[model samples]
Structures are given as structure tokens and as C-alpha cells.
Target: MSAHLLTHGIIHSTTDPYAQALLVRDGVIAWLGADDSADRVADPGDERRDLDGAVVVPVFVEPLARPADARDALSRGTAVVTVLAGPEDTGAAPADEDVQTVVYRHADRVDAEAAGVWLPVGTDTDPATLTGLLTASTQAGEQAYLVPDGGADAGPAAQDVALTALRSVAEELGTAALGRVRHRLVVTHSVTAEDRAFLAAAGVSATVVPDADGVLHAPVASLLADAVSVCLGAGPAGDPWAAVRSALSHPDPDERISARSAFAAATRTPLRALPDAPAAGLSVAPRLSVSAPAVFGVWDADAVAVQSPDGRVAAWSTDTRAGTPLLPALDAETALPRWRATWVDGRIAAEDVARDARDGATPA
Candidate 1:
């Protein structure tokens, strides 16, 4: 049975236009419209999330493959997540998120065989193991990710090495798409043309990620256009929202884009590179960006539902419902109290609150 999360007053959506209310099911937006219409069509047993005028946006997510990565992302505002490995320590679901892991990278770092089908193609890898993994995944119809700057030493995946790997595969099969080569890889420290070309020959694409600094630049920004997408780095500086801010506020005025486009770069734009990703989304948040003047200071913690593929929904809406609240946007401090009454998900889950017993042990 599909569920629903009805929100009214304001919405900043990508797929659906401004409406009084919308529906969510299986963690994805399912319907959008006015309150009366939502009431008329809503099936019984659907979850009614009144929000109490507080915002209710989709959970913002960050993609990664490590436990340490999740710990860092939660500090920022990454809500939902798409990770490569499940939690090893706390079962804590971040403040408003659910963890979705894919493959676990080896903690040992230098273990090339540990990479398996998702091969990290940098100089640090054991040449024989890397070659075998790539060849096997190619023949088995499984997707193989080429991590350029991955390995025990953690060196950037050399552009030359990546291209050479692809060239060998392409020559062996006479085509990049043949022998189970679907065309894709995951790169670190930005991407270069030769790397993109080698994978392109096999009809593969890549996801160009940033270094610890949280920046994804062009050619990496420009070359991997077809199937390439940028990640909001999962390192300490990795914040998807920050990634949106950066893309929207690119230093060069000529390169600057809209808040919505920056968001796409964080989530939707990466879809092309994620041929293996689920049809549903990862992390989602309603609009509360300083990038849009009207939405600024709103602190509308809720997310506006939107689909980047359509490029139609308003980033901010002007139409207002007659009885909407006239209250000022709540700050983080005040929001906590009201949350107790309306925190639909796990209220005491790992991160909501923690008692720091170590601080005042025995009344010291």
C-alpha cells in the first residue's frame, strides 16, 4: 500500500507546480494538489503529517561508500543517503535520514582484490587484481566503477592509467559496449578528457567527484556531461547543500547557474551517471535556499517537491492559501520543541539527542 505526506501553505517543487498539498509514498512524492482535493482523494489509513505549519521537505541526501563518510555528512545537512557500505558502529539514522549502502570499500585501503567488481583504477591498485576485476565484471554484465584516486596510498587515479585500462578493454572486445561493458566509472580528484574518452569508447560514463575541498570543476564539469555527474564530496567538506550553493554561485558569473540547477548537479544531474541507481531518489529536501531571495530567511525546514528532468516547477511560489500562518520562520532552537509533537519518524533515534555522561561523571 502506498502512503502519503500532505503539506500545504508553501511548496518549492521541481516536478509539480505550486499546489496546496502533495502526496508521498515509499519515501517518494506520489501526488500533488490542493488540501480539499487531497482530502477528497486520499485513501483511508494514509499518514497525515500536519507539519503544524512547519516545513516538510524531502530528505536531502549525499552519496558515498564509507561509514566515516556518513559520520561526516550528518554534520552538514545531508538527510537521506546512498552509501556503498552499511553502518559498522551506531545504528543511528541521521537526524532525518535512512542509510542506503552499495559496496563497502576496504578499510585496509591498499587491498586491490577488495575492490572486486567496483574496481578503483589508480596507480595504488595491484595491477593484476585490478585487471582481473575489470575483465570479470565486463564479461558478467555487472557494472564496474573505476575509482581514480582510490587505493591504500590514496593517490589520484592517473588520467593516463584510466585511459590505458579502457583502451585495452576496447581493443580486446572491438567495442566498449561489448563483453558486458555498459560504460561507467566513479572518479575522484576531478576527471580529464582521456579518461572520459576511454570509457566513452566502451559506451561508459563517469561521476566526477571533488577532493577534500568540496569542488567539482570543469572539463570535469564540462567533459563528463553526457553521463557524468558531480558529487558534493563525502569528505569533511562534503555538503550537498553547499555543493548546490557552489554550483549556483560559481565564482565566474558566466558559469554561475540557478539554485535549482545546482540541486540537479547534486541529485538529478547525477542520474545519467547512475545507470544502476534506483528509479526513486536518494536524499530530497524542500526548498529553503538562500540562493532564492523569496525563500531566504524562510527556514522552512520542509522540502519542496520537484523533478529536475521536467524543468518546469517554480523555485518559489507566489500564490498563498487563505488561512496560512503569519508566524515568523522558526530557528533551529525553537523548532526542537514543536518537533516533539510532530516528529513523525524516530524521535529518539541515534542523533536526535544524546546524554553526555562522560562530562560530569560522579558530580565531578
Candidate 2:
């Protein structure tokens, strides 16, 4: 059996909030706890990875990927990507070397049972088409994708359009159908507080492209302020760090979200939208643990810090007693954390060879 023990790191799991180490056995996370307890479970044949103060986080998910971006997504610590497949594209989506690809297509491309991915609908879609797609998506156990407006420059008008579109879908399809489909929105611009309330009530989740070039893209921080679930996407080839940073560096202080929160949006929130993904079963959120098909990223960070959403205090401390897990400093000024390794299904899919050699991490 392949076995590996990672120690001296922050394990961001709900299973054990203060766990500093974890053991992966035969591609499954068999044990995790404090660093001091790791030795009790350690075996002579297990490979050892010394994190050396690094932080371990669940691998990222790219929600708005395209065919062109598949190659490099895994190396950047994104293990899952929902690729936007066009009608002209033939055959199955090209497989990535390590990343899991879920195919997304326009509603007219194919029936939900055949397509298996979320059906995309827009403001321009006919009501009959929207109803059919929503009903098909519900029967197939998939969320129906909605893009309420032209991205980036859509502005405030987009919010109203989204609300109206969502209401119309609900009316035509019934609340039960809406429940089954669990609609997901791609919001390029801001959503008002009232819009947020309605969205939350309707069990909707929104995906935001933080790096969209237009001046009007809604800040992720603001989307996350209320109860509305928000996930981050920067297109297929966009940088995850840039999106995380953008969410953290909003110009208005009151609208800002914490680095940890922003990171979770990039990594964790997106997973919720992908309920049927194989990797989705890996995370055990309520317990704060992950199982086999274990996927995560290791980073070389200068310092880990705790942040508050209100922007009043920032502190650097790893004490588990603080009630919050520590994350790499992700503010606009701090250098982005350098990725040292990416573990997919408990295997090192990518790594900085020089750094691993220097750190004495032998291949398992």
C-alpha cells in the first residue's frame, strides 16, 4: 500500500481544525491530528513529508474553464475544472494529465441526460427553452447555469435582469424544480443587498470572475458579504492568485472579505456547486477532513496570518486556540504564496523538484 505522512503543517480541514499533520494511506486520508500524535500512528515504511511551516489547503477548482486552459490547470493547484465545451467540439472533452474535467455546454447543445453537465441559459433564452432546460437539469440532477447579462460591463442593470430571470424560471418550473436544479449564476457585475436576499432564499449560488477586464465586474468581497454563496473564477487561463487578491483588495474597506474567506471561495465554495464530481466526495466539510482521492496544494509562504472581515485587526499566529485556521498573507501588497507541490489522489502530481530535493522530501 502507498503510505505517506505529512507533518509540521497547517491542515485546513473541518475534521480537525487544529490538526498539524495527516497520514495518507493507499490514496485515502486515514488519520489526521496534532503533530505530536502523528508519531503514534507512523509506521517504518511510510514516506515522510516535512511541511516546514507550510500550509495545506484543499486544491482549487476552476469553474469557468475552456478547452485552451486545460493543460496548465493542474500545475497551478486546480484539481477540478468545469470546461465550457462548444457545439462544434467533437468527441469527449480532452482529458487533462491530472485534473478532473466536467463538461459544460449551452442548453441547446444536448438534452440534460445526455450532456450530464449543467445546461447554460442566458437572458436572451426563450422562456420555453429555459423551462425545458431547467426541467431536464432537475431530472438529471444538475444545476442549470444562468448568465443574466453581458459580463464585465453589464453594470447594475444586470442584477435586475438576473432577479427577473430567476423569478421567471421559478414560476415556470415551480420551486421544487428550482430546488432540484439548484441554479448557479455567473455574475460579472455587482448584485445589490436585495438581490442577495432573493438569491439566498432561492438557494442560488453565484460565480464571480474577479479578473474580468471591464471596470464593472462585481467584487467577490461584496458578493460574499451577505448570505449568498459566492465562488471565484478567472476564466480558463486566469491566475487563481490574482482572483484571490482582487477579492481581498477591494477599494472600499467595508466591502472587503478575509483572505481565508477569499481562499475558500476559490477552493471550497466552488466544490459545493459540483456535487456530482468524483473529487467532490473527497472533502468531509462538517468534520473538516478529506478522504481518498485526496487533492490539495502545498505552498511556500513567508508568514501565515489571521484576518477579520471588518478590517479592524490582522494578526500572525498559528495557535490553534485562536478558533480560526491560519492562512498565507494574501493582501494586495504581500507576495503570492509560491506553490511547492500539488497532491492529487494522494500522489504528487506536480512539484518544485529543486525545492523538494532541498527539503529532503523523498518520492513515495
TM-score of each: 0.59, 0.82
Q: Per-residue lDDT tens digits of candidate 2, residues 1-364?
A: 6889999998777557687899988776788889999988989988888888787877788777667676677667677776666676553344566766766665547634222444444455466655566656666666666654444344555445556667776676666666555677777765677777767777788887754551225656556666778888754237776677666666566566777787788887877765554435443231236554567788777766775655434664456555676677765456778788888777888888887687676432
* Among all candidates shown, the one with the greatest TM-score: 2
Cα error of candidate 2 at position 324, Å: 1.3
> What TM-score would candidate 1 get against the native?
0.59
lDDT of each: 0.42, 0.67
| lDDT of the structure predicted as candidate 2 | 0.67
Model 2: worst 10 consecutive residues (lDDT sum): 279-288
Which portions of model 1 miss their true places by more than 4 Å? 1-5, 24-30, 35-61, 71-97, 104-116, 124-129, 150-157, 178-184, 188-198, 218-220, 224-234, 250-258, 269-364
Superposed Cα RMSD, model 2:
3.7
